[model samples]
Target chain A: MATDDAGESLAEVGEFAVIERLVAGRRQPDAVAVGPGDDAAVLRAADGRTVVSTDMLVQDRHFRLDWSTPHQVGRKSIAQNAADVEAMGARATAFVVAFGAPADTSADLALELADGMWHEAGLLGAGIIGGDLVSAPQWVISVTVLGDLDGREPVRRTGARPGDTVAVCGELGRSAAGYALWHNGIERFDGLLGRHLVPEPPYGQGRVAADAGATAMTDVSDGLLADLGHIADGSGVGIGLRTDALSADRDALAEAAAALDVDPMAWVLGGGEDHALVATFPQAPPNGWTPIGRVLDGPPRVLVDDAAWQGNPGWQSFD
Target chain B: MATDDAGESLAEVGEFAVIERLVAGRRQPDAVAVGPGDDAAVLRAADGRTVVSTDMLVQDRHFRLDWSTPHQVGRKSIAQNAADVEAMGARATAFVVAFGAPADTSADLALELADGMWHEAGLLGAGIIGGDLVSAPQWVISVTVLGDLDGREPVRRTGARPGDTVAVCGELGRSAAGYALWHNGIERFDGLLGRHLVPEPPYGQGRVAADAGATAMTDVSDGLLADLGHIADGSGVGIGLRTDALSADRDALAEAAAALDVDPMAWVLGGGEDHALVATFPQAPPNGWTPIGRVLDGPPRVLVDDAAWQGNPGWQSFD
Candidate 1:
């Protein structure tokens, strides 16, 4: 009874009509000079340069529709892409998404996904400027985010210098713990489970780090140690984590770790998808940042308490 | 022997290692100020404003893997996105692609796909700057193109007037004809079949139209009639085509249409995906353009010889 008697699918609605439904009534931020329905959208890059990054999330691999709602998938997609833009010490201006799903997919679900994207983008004062939708065998969401540096120099991962303090703003490892719980069918940690469904990226803190004279910055999409390793490699320096500084993060996940029979430290150091902002600063960090380590003289490596971590490094696409 | 390899899938390669392998040893163009391995790529947008557009191609819906090689699909994906930039009277400067494919997909096929993308991008002197790769149930390629207007005003679809001459550059209806042939299992037309796989967008002609004082412009991704209808509706005018002027295009496809027992005029008028540059100019058309119609007083519609067309209108995403 829920199905259309005419058996209409996405192809039946047509690309333009589907687009009309997807774009109708969506509010755009001021930065978007033009939105969808044009050949291309025009965005104002206030800083004379636009920071751009892209990420693709596939069903079952990045997310399982059986576990996450369409709204959650939409949020996760935008959140991850926004985190990449934030890592550059810039404020996201607009996003263009390309989504592919089966023709048989419920139109209501698709609308819900758009709602979720708009919801997440609203957090950063950004807009969904343009997008493309097509039918595929499964859901594939690819998002590209454009950011404005606001006249400041973009923070690169290679700028960290010896003696600079490494600090982070936002919670870490909750998503990974949630993922484990979900995989093992343990549903005790509701918050952790929700965190896995939709990550809460540290909003506005990237610009905060830049204004505070941060030398380098990145988001912890990969595990903390693995992401820091990227900074070490790019900056050609060593990074040493002070476990005492991370005790709070570990303690936050202690219960979930206990339930899973895994070390909370492993979740803190080796888990990923938390999207926390980490930066290296020459002076004291910004108001919301917590100092966790120090950038060291080269040999490009990440160490836990001055010793190499022996646990799993992090996630891999091929794996 | 394959079993001895542990039948490694994307899960076995992991995300990072697979990415490392995919990114290894690919030459990047000079326009890529910053390439892959960064949080985001940095490209020099010489002009103050950047024209951006995105398109997503989903397997089975957009292209059948059985009908198209990965290389052809890659080329088609880039060609269509580039056409959008061209439609804006801008030259594509760089592209960021996000590709999702199954884990069991051969690495060689992924390489070939990238190789084809590079091949097409080279034609425009543009660079493939950054991308994201993830595992999906099917092949989904999303491409976002950035273009530079070179200080020229963008020729939007809203600018045409009643007296403007409607003209087009490049072929039309060939892709539709090809699709029909492929669908009907008519194997004789190799050129048409190949054209369907990789469209030859009228590159650089958008600027030509702009320089010729064109009022409105768009690419013929949809059928000519449907595309012109968009220009008509946007510009608050109607468009009337001269059948005699389109004879050349029809003649070129006549033989194939005859073989398939279809009307060549239908293909020429309603076919899509030729990516021909269609624009309205005030006076004599530009050097490379061929005049085909004229803008008329509105109630926005497209007509052929002052009569409504009875053929298929064009392709749509949902249908």
Candidate 2:
């Protein structure tokens, strides 16, 4: 159980002992009544409703050990799941993680992973309440986030209507662009590469958007066009984006696009995993959010400059 | 999204379409305010508290496709996670599952897995609220359960005291016995073999134990002795088990043990995954639970008939 041995393999330390080390000295939030050393964790849901979501990151698929440190993978796992909760107009309170890795993996790596998770949870003032560790052929992490809505109605994707303004808060296309940089072995874009590894989701902006009377909300996980298409389809209303409004995002990625000989607008429109909060509002957007589009009275679809722009739409798991 | 084309591989159908098939037509319980479609699901936790737990099952480690159907694996995944909440004296209200598999895996298998999960969740009046699906090299399923404590104190494993009786509700060793029978290719124990595929945890006994004043509680997940040792160590008390108290369990697996030329007591003491509820009580244990041991005022350890039993204690993830 001692944290002194940083080089031991998980098999050498054993499950219970490794668990002891992973759980040692970690501070849990006040909302957690019963923490890790129990059959299940008990968390306060003060407003009578609990918002829940889950996401799994697979080795070589969701992340690469060679490209990412265990810490970054852990952070990405927690951040992505937390983004889902944020999209629901809730503040993430706690997380329960289940991790699987080969037996030969270092216990230190697992500890580092936990440390990264703790760091991310701390940013949101949340706790990693309970987890299960197991042996697998490759590292796989599944994180489930629990969120607090503070008695507000969840901002669902079905609430957008005609005449509503669509806005976004946080960076867009950085993750996809970062992936290109990493994949192409171009190390010059340090900030973009780091953003891809550990995304900075506009955490509390979700509740702000909710309070601002946003009609619908979702996080941009599967590219701007693809994710907004979900909102459009769900709300049975079309969405029209102004290219001029997304010019800043395009400009941000312009240097990288020129370096890669690619279109910067493609990354801005079709890139994913930036975890930016996008919502539709009937009035002027919230202060921190930038209005880039509007809901329209038409069949469900997403248009660029009021026209269907052709390119890669977005990511799909199987693809 | 149509269920008729069950033969297509996940890659051919894509992620969102497969998710639509998985989510369609499932009736959610009243506790679910928003289910499946949204970025996150919302559930009412009437008592201001939520009990949460998670587990991961990897291919050829936790289960096998050749030996168990996708449905069985799904049921096992949900059942095991639900048991953890049950051990905490709460009724599981909803679940969010994250699953990974090869792109070539049939979409039908995924649906069958959801069917199996739904079948098991139905037993507890819970619903599958949300999930993520991704591509991986092999099948990996992670399930997170949410439960309501209904205003009662959560029964933790640190409450046992000297002189308290240890009891168990639900079958013991059946899963291990079934494993041994299947391993040896001696297929006489039909009941045990089926149990190995899908465990039957005593659904409502955790609350019953809590209502009956159980001081310390945990599920028999890592085996009776190993899990009870958790209680013993957490509560700073020793435990003494009476073999006579476990005679019924031994008898149940007697034929299978003989056929495999193994000791029935070993399975009763060391086997796991039966998901039986084990707790320590200050007074007589409630009906439907069999008394198996007593807490001793000494160092933390487990003994059989007042002495340590020399055999395999239980399971470890790395092992």
TM-score of chain B of each: 0.95, 0.98
TM-score of chain A of each: 0.96, 0.98
How does model 2 do on interface RMSD, in angstroms? 0.5
Per-residue alpha-carbon lDDT of model 2 for A175-224, expressed as tens digits? 99999999999999999999999999998999999999999999999999
Candidate 2 local lDDT, B1-319, one digit each (tens): 2223359999998999999999999999999999998889999999999999999999999998877888999999999999999999999999999999988888999999999999999999999999999998889999999998887899999999999999999999999998888788876878998898999999999999999999999998999999999999999999999999999999998888887778999999999999999999999999999999899999999999989989999999999
Q: What lDDT does candidate 1 reach at residue B124?
A: 91
Q: Which residue runs does candidate 2 get wrong by more than 4 Å?
A: A1-6, B1-6
Q: Estimate the Cα RMSD of every predicted model relative to the unseen true structure.
A: 2.9, 2.5
Q: Grade the docking of candidate 1.
A: medium
What does DockQ come to for candidate 2? Answer: 0.93
Q: Model 2: what TM-score?
A: 0.98
Candidate 2 C-alpha error for residue B68, in Å = 0.6
A217-266: candidate 1 lDDT, tens digit per residue: 88998889989999999999999999899989899999889888899898
Runs in model 1 with CA error above 4 Å? A1-12, B1-14, B21-31
The DockQ leader among the candidates is 2
Give the lowest summed-lDDT range of ten residues in model 1 chain B.
B1-10
